[model samples]
Target: MFRRRPARELSADDLLTTLGRLTAQARAGAELQRARVELAEALQREMLPAALPGVPGVRAAAAYAPARNGLDIGGDWYDGFPLPGGRLAFCIGDVQGHDVEAAAFMGQIRMGLRAVAGGGADPGVVLARANELLLSVDSPLFATCTFLTFDPVAWEVVAARAGHPPGVWATADGRCGIAEENGGAPLGVLPGETYPVTYWRLAPRGAFALLTDGVVEGPSFPIEAGLAEAAKRVRDRAPTGDPADVAAAVMDVAEFTGHTDDAAVVVLCYDRADRDNG
Candidate 1:
């Protein structure tokens, strides 16, 4: 109870101990930050498939490149899910940012697409519903996208674009061109925007590619030139190349562009079911 013991004098050893503790804390904090970044990147990467879904007469392949100029993950995503009547819905989009928040928004948008697309609905309606879902979320981030339903049985395509670059297509005879950008505003931007439906026919051994702007746009390279070059490369590979190889060809367009953003490509190649059987 007594007189308080004299305050412990600040000795060199005591100072050293305190400094060591602070250093350790700082190191631990840095490590924690690194871990969090890694986790976010992994989750974002996992959201997009490493191997796209496969169906009879339709082979899908994808290639992804994260942003080379930043450590944080960017928000480019693509997926293929089964639809009713042996059809499949494929989407590729770029959410606006290179951070964890963008990735989270991307996840929500993808889930909404899958949920609304279950009935094999028209592509325009599907996009409109998805836009509502995105708008309802408490986020400022918006996305540009192309959504489409492909019927492997009919070799038909019904697609809708939302303020995004038009997709590219190549027939078996080496004819290739880009789609018309008849798109509405990007998702989560304007309320009640309408996405127009566009029809396309896929010939046997033909291919369609959905890609983000990163694959064809750069500071020094114009998208127009890049797209033309991409079409040529894709047409060169679409006839006999595997979907993976063809997807790479699409990505290769950025080589001259020197693109620094994240890039993603999903290629859908169509072949007659009877081709292998015959």
Candidate 2:
């Protein structure tokens, strides 16, 4: 009986051929998934601006850190461009989520802000228009952001925010203060909300820090604790030589353990005169 059953079974060659084809198909699927991930990452990197625009009487630099390991590039971004009145426009913002769609939405919001800001709109007006655009476009997504203007002649900087964390400002004597002002809800959150504008004068050699929540929100730490860490680094590394350096120091602290989210920061150090002459 056993001999008869064996004779009725398929040949070994046929079984091996079937197994080989199945393995090949599984490998092809894996390769395709990998290709998709790579494509997504490349697209994300392309979203960031190539270089920050030049601003009179200011040496500014910015840096962004993506997650330690993932397919997500990030939703955080910074932009520097000239305003209509010879003033400079600088902005930083972060979308609520991290994904391809979120990044696309971020690009749309950024372009809209630029269009409004380019028209010499104040920070408050810029935020309001941005909110309206988000709602009208039906691209409803929450975002925290700050818009700022720097006037070299007046040595002044005006800022406005929408549910973004307060920026950091440090005096010449090593004293640092958080820039807290009344703000409206984040964009695409609730329409018809108003964001108040705030003003501050930049002392010669003053340092200002604008950061995204990715730097503060973490697993083992709260926002306050993370802010404290940034302060300590700033104090210890007093008079950070450049904006990029300060950004790196902050990232070093947050990434000491690992990157939780996309960390982006803009550091502006006001010097009495341009370094190019020196």
Candidate 3:
């Protein structure tokens, strides 16, 4: 058997070399993570609507902000479009988790909702059908969503929710309150859940808002408090302005700085002038 020589201890030079290599590896890993986050942000932006639809009897506006930490991408999304029967559909949703996968799932659910609504289904039916579609896909993620179909001709709005936050309703004279309704389980949670629809008369020159949790829930504030604060903000700013301006004003009150969750909002204003023109 050959005799083995004694092992020599690592010198400072050797240690320095090893540390340099480790540092380089860490830097490379961080760079790769940053690239992935950028890609996810871009993908999320691509999935959102470029502009909210302008219906004859309603003025609509939407705003979206991604997370400020980690991947900087979350499953918060908003959509508004005119349906076939001259009704306008507005939706806001937040999928579980903050990642690219959640965002992708959100896109699928939103498209499915639009398809079902286009078939002239009511808000409740649209959500029910969308839930079935998600189950068929076997999606592991679940989401909270609120859908509303506004019929300008009838001056009514039909609304449905799937574990989403209550919508804020404001009268033309600046009075505001939350419209609480019974909601079913979130989509992808139960195979056959029934969504209930609530009908409300649209107030002249009034507006309704759909928002994700990120807009209301924060570190220091509870959900109820946030809703109250938001309602006040809406009441103050919604008296006169375009939908877009109102949306911006409401979001400004949310104070998103240092918040971890993403936010999305959609404001639909029923101006008497628009109805008269239609």
lDDT values of the candidates?
0.85, 0.76, 0.83
- After the best TM-score superposition of candidate 2, give how far the Cα of residue 82 lies from its true spot, in angstroms: 1.3
For residue 73, model 2's alpha carbon misses the true position, in angstroms, by 3.1
Tens-place lDDT per residue, model 1, 1-278, is 69988987899999999999999999999888678678769779768766777676778898888888646677899988888887888999999987778888888988899999996679899999999989887589999989998876667889999988888888779899988758899999988899999988767678889989999899988888888888887889988748898999999886668988988899988787533554
TM-score, per-candidate, Cα-based: 0.86, 0.83, 0.92
Report the lDDT tens digits of candidate 2 across residue range 1-278: 35544565768998999999999999999787667657556655676677766564576678778875565556787887878766877889988766667777888888889988887878999999999889897875778899898887677899999989877777557887668778889988787878899988776776777888787667776777777677666554437547677767766666753457888888777765653344
| Candidate 1 off by > 4 Å | 1-33, 273-278
In candidate 3, which residue pairs clash? none
Q: At residue 12, give the lDDT of candidate 1.
A: 98
* TM-score, cand. 1 vs. native: 0.86
lDDT of 3 by residue, 1-278 (tens): 99999899999999999999999999999998788777767767887889887667688888776675665578898888888878888899989976668778988988999889999998998999999999899878999999998887888989999999998878778689998988899988997899999999877777788888788887776878777776777777677747777787667646733346888789887786776877
What ordering of candidates by TM-score runs from best to worst?
3, 1, 2
Q: Give the TM-score of candidate 3.
A: 0.92
**Candidate 2 C-alpha error for residue 46, in Å:** 2.3
Q: In lDDT terms, which candidate is top?
A: 1
Question: Candidates 1 and 2: which is better by lDDT?
Answer: 1
